[model samples]
Target: MSDCDDRALIEAAQKDPLAFGALYERYVDRIYNYIFHRVGNVYDAEDLTSRTFFRALSHLADYQDQGYPFSAWLYRIAHNLVANWHRDRSRRPVIALDEIVARSLSEQHPEVVTEARATMRLLREIIRTLDPVRQELLVLKFAEGLSNAEIGKILGRSEGAIKSLYHRTLLQLREEMEKRERGER
Candidate 1:
């Protein structure tokens, strides 16, 4: 895990407010990106990301180290919040990395703008077509770099089960990609 063990940070934060800032600094971008990718918009993503952290902060005292790691717990919270948002809004949202990359490209470097835009568009379409669970798995595994065991912890399954599911999900994604390519051809 990252050296910013949330458990330790939370513990310290209970005593010192400054410690919580460190935690926020460490996780804010990730939480934002995660939500943005899932919801496909800036407003909802920002709201959900803030709510996730707020809930975490409010429930910090209830947190315990189950040896599963802290990110899992935070992700679980974020996932539940997003699910609730979906339920309440009665909408299935899709977050496109293309939007994010485009914003960055516009702000910083214009040279690679074309390449980044194309890649992000393809990536966003592929991600949008994935089953919701597969999309979450990819976010956790590839984007967050969490292990299968950690994914299981976040997802409430066993490590073996998570590994099996990930394999199956990858196969499904490959088949879908191939089918899309064939159709394009």
Candidate 2:
């Protein structure tokens, strides 16, 4: 864990409101990225991102260290908020695969980017098809580049259990990608 612990900051914030801004500044980017990946829209991402911090600030008194970093606790709040958003909407987000493909192609070459974009688009689509828990697990493991142990803290699972789930989730994603390819061919 880094020396700059957010739990301590949160505790301090509970005593003084101004201290909370430090925590917000520290995590705004990460939280925004996390929310953006889940929601796939900058506008909704911004709103949810703000809401995450707002909710966290309100519940700051309830936060406990529990060995995990303060960022993990904040992530839990963001994760729950995303889940609730999905449930309330009752509609899966429509990821803009074309935009991703176009941006990749423009940055590289159509020939070079085409296959990669297709794979990424398929991957994103397949991820959405999985259960919410699986989806969150994959996003945190892959997109956020979190270690299994770190993920365990965020999701409140054993590190070993997280490793197992990570492996299984990767296998499932690979199978889904392969199936998509086979169908295309």
TM-score of each: 0.77, 0.88
Off by over 4 Å in 2: 1-4, 97-107
Off by over 4 Å in 1: 1-5, 99-123
Candidate 2: minimum summed lDDT over ten consecutive residues — where? Answer: 1-10
Kindly list the per-residue Cα lDDT of model 2 for residues 1-185, writing each as its tens digit: 36357656777899988899998998898888788878888888999999999998898877776777888988988998898888899889756657856774787867778878777778889988887777777778766788888888888899999888878988988898888888952
Tens digit of per-residue lDDT, candidate 1, span 1-185:
35356667778987776677777887888777777767878999989999999898888778777776677777888999888887898766766566557777896667689877865666567767777787887888887777888788888889899899899887876776677657762
lDDT of every model, 2 decimals: 0.78, 0.82
How displaced is residue 143 in candidate 1, in Å?
1.7
The alpha-carbon lDDT assigned to residue 82 of candidate 1 equals 83
Residue 120 lDDT, candidate 2, scale 0-100: 75
- Candidate with top lDDT is 2
